[model samples]
Target: MTMQVRGSKLAARLTASMAALALLGTGAVALAQNWSTTVVASDNGHKVGNPKAKTKLVEFMSYTCSHCADFAREGDAAIKLAYLPKGDVSYEIRHLLRDPFDLTAALLTQCGDPKKFMGNHNAIILSQEDWFEKGRKTTRAQQARWQFGSNGARRQAIASDLGFYELMENRGYTRAQLDKCLIDEAKANALAEASQADVEKYGLTGTPSFVMNGALLDGVHNWAALRPVLDKQR
Candidate 1:
């Protein structure tokens, strides 16, 4: 009798484990299916094109990436011409962990009025080549080797390279805010956590990637290639 009861309990435990696994798998599928182009943030966050447009496009970019800059300068013109002006699509840009300097630049961009978000985005993209000429490269591997390796040193370097740190000085953020943005333990943890979430959720592995109304588009292709799809959605 004792042996039979133990076997029954063991079978029940196995069944419970299998049920839990099934639920986990179902949750992951739901998350993937629900992956959205919209980033719900207070204060409008960083957006472009039409705010109330029917379609939503989200861009994952890094300020330090030349390819991303190319997309911003060359590709954006066509994007703006088509989706932005038509009130058919709303655009959003989010940052993934490309490098530490990218974080510093992001902090600077987010420092001022959220109204000028795109302005700051353009400023960084436009200056990409110039900054590279002056020996500031914003590549993923390069950033990891240099910036994340030493947060304090990288912060000071960016304070000199970009006026972002200084701009926030008068904004009532003590040294703590500046350092917190650069080395804030929580923010750093959050970036890492969010990055992993983005990767698994979106199957994204690089920058300059886009999701146009839930359609995933990756690469450096021109807007000519993008219009047909955008048009169909319209």
Candidate 2:
């Protein structure tokens, strides 16, 4: 009977050790990965408030996503007011480009000065409703053509004709800068590849996702519901 009791204790210890090892393995993997922010020559990234506060809140977003726009309109202000201004939290916006056009916007957004990240972010979010509404009138096949087509020249022409090019131009990007950003095949491909790597690493399938520390906030339909989670992290 004593031998049996001793064996049981040994098994328990072994199981506990294995569990601890598993936890450590997960942390080691997460630590190995880097999550540096990407900025391109385009106007696709968005930031609403503080960038250097303590609790970093990184949001994954796409330009074409209505839900993303909703978060921009509703939750962004509250998050900025309650958390950002106090220096308790900092936020980073990352691109989740779905197609080649989305890539264009992403590239343009990142094209400017890194310090202008917030301005570029705010610009995209402010124009969200209008751009989305205009985009929806087109057929899905056309949208897909806009997004995934292999013909870079034609695709960019479509983006320009649709006023995406003009939109950034209005934002003070010179024609030369816009053309340079749009035609750089290497940079755009790299950005797309990096964004894809992030999606797979995070195991995410949708846009407008949030990562507050290690905890995930799946969506941002409303801010009142999200405060407690951020507060708890504080």
Candidate 3:
């Protein structure tokens, strides 16, 4: 399918998924105690909490995905404040690229230092509506930029003309620095390859999917449904 067709289908699926998750009710209550900590980039994700933690939780997410954004808004603090402090569970976020916009956002997030990845990730997700709106308004000439040139050129065009560069700039990134990141062909290709492998390996159908201890989670996509599963692991 064409990129436009694929993006439309993905957006429809994401909206439906977000609606379903919303009906699941509010998320689990916050933990009484909280701790300050940081997460680092790993092989396929940003790793947070103890590496040796017995229960490993991974989230396969796309930046353009509304459900993934919801999870970030609803469940992120709980994970960091409640679970990470316990030191028995570790959380990692693996990107599941859904489109050019998702690819751009993923690259920009990775451009930051590993220690700042999650912070940048959260900032992007939290402001999803703003940048995604800008993306949808991209002119035909801007859209065509993706079809030609080196991967770096394509990324730079998307980031510069599509408003992603401005978005990152507001987050403290310089235009020169972001331009270099857009050209990092290795990082971009590795991310895409990894996401493709996940699609085939897990038979993924949507974003915000979950895995526990190396197994794809079944029948539990939202944080409300996922909390109990993590509790069992703990």
Each model's number of backbone clashes? 0, 14, 0
Model 2: CA > 4 A from native: 1-52, 136-155, 218-224
1 versus 3: better lDDT goes to: 3
Q: What is the C-alpha RMSD of each candidate to the true structure, in Å?
A: 16.9, 15.1, 21.2
Clash-forming residue pairs, model 1: none
Worst 10 residues of 1 by lDDT: 35-44
Model 2 lDDT, residue 123, Cα: 73
Q: Residue-wise lDDT of candidate 2 within 1-234, one digit each (tens)?
A: 999999999999999999999999999886553223322232224444444456777688887777777777777766656666545576667788887556766766666676555555567666867666666677766666665545466447655645677677777878777777677788777877778877887766887787776457765434555667788866
Query: Which of 2 and 3 is the better model by TM-score?
Result: 3
lDDT of 3 by residue, 44-86 (tens): 6688887878888889999889989989988888888778886
- Model 1: residue 182 alpha-carbon error in angstroms: 4.3
Q: What TM-score would every model get versus the actual structure?
A: 0.62, 0.67, 0.80
Query: Which order, best to worst by TM-score?
Result: 3, 2, 1
Deviation (Å) of 71 in candidate 2 = 0.6
Cα error, candidate 3, residue 185 (Å): 0.8
lDDT order, best first, reads 3, 2, 1
**Model 3 TM-score, all chains together:** 0.80
Which model is ahead, 2 or 3, in terms of lDDT? 3
